[model samples]
Structure formats: C-alpha cells, structure tokens
Target: MEFINIALSNLPVTPENNQQPSEGMQTGLDLKEKLSEKMKMAVEHDFFAGIYYLQGKYGHTYRELSTSRNLLQQIYREILEYYIDGTWVLLESAAPIILRTQDAKSKHFLQLGFRDLESSRLFHQRGSNIGKKLYTNQINFYKQGIKRVRRARKYGVLAILESRTPVEEKKEYQYVSYDEVRNPSITEDVKEYDRVLNKMIGLISRQLVDATIQSSTRGYPLELDLIEMHQDNFGAIIPDHPHLLNRFLSEVETAKFHERQKLPDRSRPSR
Candidate 1:
C-alpha cells in the first residue's frame, strides 16, 4: 500500500494582506450602478410627489380630485419616465405644464373660498380623504424613494472616493488623532487592529453581496444592501435581509478572533 498525502486547502484561507475576496470588486461596481439609478428614481419621485401633495390638498378643498390626480399624475408619470430613461426632454416638456396646470384647481378653490369661509370649510370636510387613499400611495412611494436615494448616494460617494484614492499597503501602521495629535490611551496594537479591522470590514461587505447573489436568495428587498454598513463617504444602506447580513457579521467575528490571536497583546506589566 502506498501512503498518500492530503492537503488542507479545502479550508477557508484567512486573509493576510487586506483585499476583497472573489468577485468583490465587480459586485461593488454593479452595486454602485444600481444604487445611482435607484437614487435618481427616488429623488425625482420625491420632487414631483411633494408638489403634487400641495396641489392635491388645494384640489381636495374644491373637490376637483379627478382633475388634481390627472394634473399631478402627468408630472409624476413624466418624472418616473425621465428617471428610468434619463431623458431631459420629458422634464423640459413637463415643467411648464406642471407649473401651469398643477395649481389651477387649488387657485380655483382659493378664489371660491375667500368669498365664504363657512362654505369652504364645509366643502373641505365633505371632500376629506376623498382622494386620500390614492394620494397616500404617492406619498409612500415618495418616502421610500427618498430613503433609497439617500442610501444610494451614500454608497455611491464612498465608492467614488475609494476608487479615487485606493488605500496603500503600509509597513508602518498609522493612528487616529484627537484634534490634531494622537491620543495616549490608544496603543500601537489597537491602532494596528483598527487598520486591519476597517479594511476587513470593507472587504467583508463586498463579499457578503457576492455571497448573496451566489445563494440565489429570495426574501430580500427590492434592492437590499447586504452590508448595512455606512461611512461618511459611503452612505447607509439599511439591512433588508437578516440572513444575508448575518454572513457579513460572521466574517467580522472571524476577523476579530484572528486579530486577537495574531496581533500583539495589549497589557501592562506590574511594577
């Protein structure tokens, strides 16, 4: 019988130099494109929806809801179409129309109202929430739209900055300064740990996204950011799927364990 040697290459290799795992860079790029488009959708929706809300209120007072929805619907529809298609012509064509048409019902209601407060208020009461359910749909759409926009812009900025200034590998570690100088309390080991940890966190986030895609997972949000990680440069993408997020947390915990074992010990010698 011949003795055969087996390799333990099957085990996950712990990262030495901080870098993204497989498909991490491509995934990050894809995520950035998706986020930017979503942000555009959200912010535009917010703009039209806000204006529509004001117009709708006035229309409600006069009970011209059908006209109000029609007017605002065109604006909302154009805004969405522009967002999806990146067409400036839609905005140009819609702008004057929105300005001219959206407020007409409200103006009519106001002209009717100054003459009689009792009658105006009574009319408003009768028309309360008449178009509200449909109106609320627009409001909800705007709210979520803005949230997604904010989230995307945050990550988009981060990705932009990261692309511009890639982190250089350093033989000598750096430290966080208080005001302008380093704090005495923060030891060298802690500083090194922080550097490694931060880099690992960024990598783990990209990998988490890749893993989620690989799993072909469902039960995630329309466009969930698996990382749920945010920075000044990288805006917040709130966790949409707990299961996907857990994978990232798992990577972080593993890194922490390895760092504790590998890095220099932080302790004081008794005098």
Candidate 2:
C-alpha cells in the first residue's frame, strides 16, 4: 500500500511552463489527482487481499518457494532449447514440450495475480527431469554459442578451440576447444581424448566416494548422494539414452573430459 501511495503521489501534470493556470485547469488537475489516488488504493487493496488468500489456502510458504523454483526451471529450459536447436521450437510447440508449457502456465498464473494456487502447484509439478536437464546442459553451450556469434561478426568462420579458459591462473597454455572437451577426435587437435577421459573418470569417482565417506562421518545422512550414485549406476546400464544428459550427469561430464564419448571409426549407424 505504501508503494502504491508513493507511486501515485509522484504523478505529474503536464502543463506549459509559461501558461497561467485557469480555474478549469485547476479543477481538471484536482480531479485527476483524486482519481489517481483512488486507483492506487484499489490496486493495493486487491494485492493484499490476494496475498491473504494464498496464506489461508496454501499449506505453507515453502509451497510458494517451490513454485518460484519451478518457475525459474521453466525459464531455464526455454532458453536452453532455443540455444541447442538454434530455433524457438518451444515458442510454438505445445503439449509434449514439458518446459515451455510450464513457462506458459507460470506466465498466465502470475499475470492473473496468483489467485489460483492449486493450478499453479499442478503447473509446477508438470515439469520433468529431462526438461530440467536440457536447461542445465545448455548454460555453457549458450555462453560458447554467443562467443561464436560475436566472432562470426568479424571472422568468416567460428574458430575451433578459440573459446577456452586459462589453466592454473596462467594464459600461457594453448587454448583448448569445447568441442574437444565434449566430442574429441583423433586429429592433432585432440590427440589424447581417451587419456583425458580416463583421468577425469578416476578423479570424479574418487571425489564422489570421498564425499560420501565424509558425509557418513558427519551426523547428516547423505540421502541425495546415494540417490545420485543409484542414478549414475542406472545411467551406465543404458548409456545411449539421451536422458543421461541431466544435471546429475552434467557435473560428472564437466569434471570428467566433459563426457566426450567416442564416435565410431567406421560407417555411421543407420536410423
């Protein structure tokens, strides 16, 4: 209400600086000021009423916090799909597109001003793990994609291995490619993808095991870590499925040769 009052009070009347104020001008200004104040008060009243309703209806504040998290997840997914396919398929596609649909519902519910808590809750639950992963996977991808776009503005082609971070606080190391990080080849550019991948795998596995051991020593139970272990084990069973590209595996991927699986040396697999 105070915010509303402040905003309303700041409203200005547009009158010529040199013009003298007539009785009619003064009367119109007074009416406008009154109407603006009334409108602000009404808006504030409605806003508080809605909040009160949510407080009464919802289970608790965590439910609302969860909804906010899901909303952010939806936004992340939308932006990710746009980057990956380099097309706004989510912008048009419906039903099967889990994330975009959630985003739409989030927008609609927020626009309607959060009156329908149940609808919003159900909307939040509509999102899936894959949808969440797709969003997470594309963060670095988009950063590289944007850098590529900027370079393309000058160079005719985007340079491979041009996008790289410094190693050990030293810029002296040759720039490593993200492509090499994700899908290394046997060329001089990626002479040792296998060696890198093996080292990364060992490092990640040891870290996870150590973390699990340390957490066990502490009073806090490592439920989430166990769940992650189970998922990783499951993912190993079916490495071909696209769903392995979730946040859980993404960390493993980034820490371990960025999950650069070897392509076949022979003919491409038939569809």
Candidate 3:
C-alpha cells in the first residue's frame, strides 16, 4: 500500500550515511503522535456510545457518539491543513523533499474517521423505532465525513505532486517549478499515492453499498436515497475515476435483484 510505502520511506535510518531527519519529517511525527492521542479518546467515547446504544439509552448514545464523531471531524480538518501546509513547503523548497510521513498520517486519520462513521451508522440502523429525522441526520453526517476525507486525500496528492523537482536544478533555483519539470521518482510517488487513494475510495464505496443493502433488508428502504447521496458526495469528488462510481452502481443493482428474489411471490393466488 502507498501508505505503508510512504511510512517506510520516511523512517530515520542510521548515521552511517550521515543522513538526518528533515523539519517536515519531525513535524509529521509530532503531529501524528498528537492525532493518535486524540483518536484514542474518540475511540473510548465511541465504545461507551456503543454500550449505551445496546442498553437502549439512545440519549446517552447521541451525546457520547457525537463527541466521538466531532473529535474525528476535528482531526480530519487538522489532517487537511497539514497537507495544505506541506504543499506550500514543497512548492518553496529548493531541493526535492518527499513529505510522505505527513501524507501517510493524514490518510491514516481520514481512514479512521471513515470507518468510525460507517460503523456508527450501521449500529444505529440495527436499532428499532429509529426516527426518520435521526436516520437522515446520520446519513448526512456520514456524507460530510466522506467529503472531508476526500478533500484531504485530494490535498495529499497535490502535496506529493508539489515535491516533484529535478535534482539537477535544486542547487540553482530557490523555488523549484513543480509543473515545468517532472522528476521520475516523484512521478512514481504520485502514481503510488493515487493507487492507494483509489483503493481506499473503492473500499468505502463497497461498504456504502453493503450498508444500503443491509438497511433495506431491515425495512429502511434507503437504497435509492443512500446511493444517490453517495454518488453526489463521494462519486462527484473523483471526476477522473468514473469507473469506481460505475462499479458501485452495478453492485447496488445486483444487490437489489437478489433482495427482490428473497421476497415471497405474491403473483400466486392465496390458497
């Protein structure tokens, strides 16, 4: 995975080569540590929320899970800022510097938020007598989370692309023109970054489809609403990758067909 590759590439090696960690690397590590701490707190809240949900204490569930979800959203924004800031640094650097650590960290937090929100939605869906307002709110919250994460991923790609500077020109130029020249190494990095984000997006799309199917089976009949909302939010974000959207729609159709097959045949006359 690109995330793993980026993390491995940023590891501080022994001084045999007289190499030292860059400012970007140290900053990335510090930010990651802070974010990790925050995420732990969020997880605890989510756990308590789950317990409250199971105990039929939805009031408590709402308060605790809201806390957790808000924290995750805060972390998501921080990650987005990190990428945006990193892009500026990359654009200003005289030498080529890959801040994959920053990218990796940002992607990690986004993925966590994605999973947490999806799990929460599924958990709430399983409950009896959930109001339409509550269901709509949950779906909207999930959509917003998806949008924030996708934006972070987009900025992460920009940061990677910003780091593509020719080695020969580093000494002469104070600010490398990322667009004028394409470094092969940096090109590879961008490709790897896209590959990883694409995979993540595909996974999330599948999960959304699965969740829609599950909700429908539970009598929510949210297939069209959820699918349309997802396409509008998630699918619209990646205009370059229409295939992912297409595959998601196809899966929804297949799921609907199977679901229809499971229903009792009403065409036969009652005995």
- Pick the lDDT winner: 3
lDDT of 1 by residue, 31-71 (tens): 33443343333333333444446656553333334433433
Error of 2 at 53 (Å): 17
Give the distance in Å from residue 150's predicted Cα in candidate 1 to where it truly belongs: 3.3
For all predicted structures, in order, the TM-scores are: 0.24, 0.17, 0.34
lDDT of each: 0.32, 0.31, 0.41
lDDT of 2 by residue, 70-144 (tens): 433433333222222211111112113223334343243232322222232222334332355443333333333
Off by over 4 Å in 2: 1-59, 87-157, 160-271
Provide the lDDT at 208 for model 3.
Answer: 22
Error of 2 at 6 (Å): 30
Winning model by TM-score: 3
- Compare candidates 2 and 3 on TM-score and give the better one: 3
Higher-lDDT candidate of 2 and 3 = 3
Candidate 1 vs candidate 3: which has greater lDDT? 3
Ten-residue stretch with the least lDDT total in model 1: 1-10
